[model samples]
Target: MDLLRRRAEAVPRGVATAAPIFADRADNAELHDVEGRRFVDFAGGIAVLNVGHRHPRVIAAVADQMARFTHTAFQVVAYEPYVALAERLNGLAPFSGPAKTIFLTTGAEAVENAVKVARAATGRSAVIAFTGGFHGRTAMTSALTGKVYPYKAAFGPMPPEIYHVPFPAPALGVTVEDSLRALAFLFAADVPANRVAAIIIEPVQGEGGFHVAPFALLRELRALCDRHGILLIADEVQSGFARTGRMFGIEHSGVEPDLVTVAKSLAGGFPLSGLIGRAEIMDRVEPGGLGGTYGGSPIACAAALAVLDVIEEEGLIARADAIGERLSARIADYAASNAMAPIANLRGLGAMVGFDILDAAREAPDGLRARQVCARALNEGLILLNCGVQGETIRILVPLTASDAIIDEGLDMLAAALAE
Candidate 1:
């Protein structure tokens, strides 16, 4: 049977797969499908493989751990890799005060535990997120998430005490004042400020368009959380690790958050996520309250250690800034050269860059053109991903390991698609 036909028969329709081909192998920034076709991978498994697919060091680490023994269950028999990883992440946290780390299996799990920790520590139940922020697919996170339609639609009767206010996007006409006013209104009309336990936000709104929260606005939220005695949670699931220029996106704002949830690109392809926060706040959760059977698996921890090493040795943190500059410059030049193309509001933080697809008159976001551009790129051996609630944004999640040649090639393909 054809692969797409086979997938249709076996997999549920609710699960969305962007690329149609079945990958036979992937390395660095390219994926080879079952039909033996090569495609330059700009999506990076949606920002999961910053060190690129199957980096030699990461492969070696996983191999060595598997040979020793894969699972004794860290809960059943403690291991050193898990502890070592926690120490490394805790040390890497941007906060000055003492921090602690807890491992989980996915970004959603990290998010859930962050909220749980906030509620436990503060003895308050209400939580607030921003409009257009994408947290997770779980019930509470679904409630916390700002978008509806595909994520929250038909999954209703959501958990309560979760509210959303506007996030600043000056080009979109949503200003910092507009966001602050919405928050003030939320406090008055909906949940009271004192009742709120946490206010979670994405420094760079992922899956909701790469709208980097303004530095002043984040500082403002930090002060508000301080006044209300509420924990500030930064959902760095998509922008964490070295994907952005800094280790954490929130660091760009120079504001500290009480808790940060991380996952994608943490293990260089292994399933791992972490929730790091102030030690006092994290300690409030009772023993046995956070963590799962598969949480912090030794194999994943080993891979994570190797990932950190690769980031340092390859100087990927610095490379991310360079890549962001290159991508942004090339895309801007492409837009200038193609006057008829409808690209606008090009923005990003570090390597996490994207542009809005607008109508020919540049009056409105154009979801149809965005989708067509992405599909056209896929046919031309370049894999791209779209974002925003209206699907009117195309964001580059290219692997940091991609060479200058491959980056140019992929951008050329993107430019070709844009012209189409």
Candidate 2:
């Protein structure tokens, strides 16, 4: 706690609320601290290390790029890696028409740029986002984010005209029709639909919980957006890259979004994000309307290219489905057994899985108990993350590359923690 406490004082207080573990090194799906304590990494750097930690291919790519050049500021002198990476992303995205890709440094940048592009194309000022969706921390993204406690606590006076509606969860008593009703209500009560430029969502909410948006709901949203001329933006920062079985989370419904924002595991660990959209729509932003000094760093682009190679060669998308099936079955077994606290409303797609902790009476959500279980799991050498509107659900985002032994060990720790 000494180093962490010091960090709290030196760094902005808002940036330090997660688990206090200070990692020294990591590999595959295991992390070691300064004191040499080993823990199975179920968090995967908040789902950024899909290729696992310190992947050999990613390491070689970065090392090889570093030997040649680290920075040239894509705006000044263009690089081949950036162009090639964008080409790959454009082809891989779910869009049927010709697509264009723009690289950025983080998910928030991609999101902000996507919005800018949407506004530019539609000439509208308002945007709609769903509650429980986690966008990012930038001023505009903070405004776009649906959760209130941590993301919007002190940050207020957020960008205006960003309306929020309920995200559907049938297990939680909200249906697709309910979501549609909310959207209709928003337009009638809050803002007019014609003024809305875009509606962005996480196909599987990240910080909100691993709730998969229903297929019917996504299709309806797409239809609504199409009819109303509102662009559909899918924020795939946490659910992208084989995390949800499909390369993109939106693929679960077989619907195509006008724009898709991707980051997190896109570069396997490097800081890189991209906005992929229809070529005609993406071209709305003029030459200088989109871009940043470090938007497409050469090193990050090289690492992303390597990540694509690894995903293809390793068949990670298929592996994600298998992993999720196994994990869901194990969780279902634990839920059936009364050995640990009851897991209610267990749901997810692919490797993104979550279950809510039930109350002592085994009825309602027990948020405090969920936090305790996460803490105990961490102490017992397993890493887990808690989510949900009230923080009552536990979500697992283990690397697609993690082995069966590691996954089982992490689950055992979780079971023990719940029992305690």
The candidate that achieves the highest lDDT relative to the unseen native structure: 1
Cα error, residue 316 of model 2, in Å, equals 0.5
Off by over 4 Å in 2: none
Off by over 4 Å in 1: none
**lDDT for each residue of candidate 2 in 157-224, tens digit (9 for 90 to 100):** 88999999888996578888888999989999999989999999999999887889889988999999
Model 1: per-residue Cα lDDT over 1-420, one tens digit each: 399999999999999998888999999999999999999999999999899999999999999999998988777899999999999999999788999999999999999999999999999999999989998899988888899978887975889888899888966689999999999999999999999999999999989999999999999999999998999999999998887898899999899999999998999999999999999999999999988999998999999999999999999999999999999999888767655468888999889999989888878998888988999999989999999978899999999999999999999889888884
lDDT of 2 at 183: 92
Per-candidate TM equals 0.98, 0.98
Q: Assess candidate 2 and give its lDDT.
A: 0.91
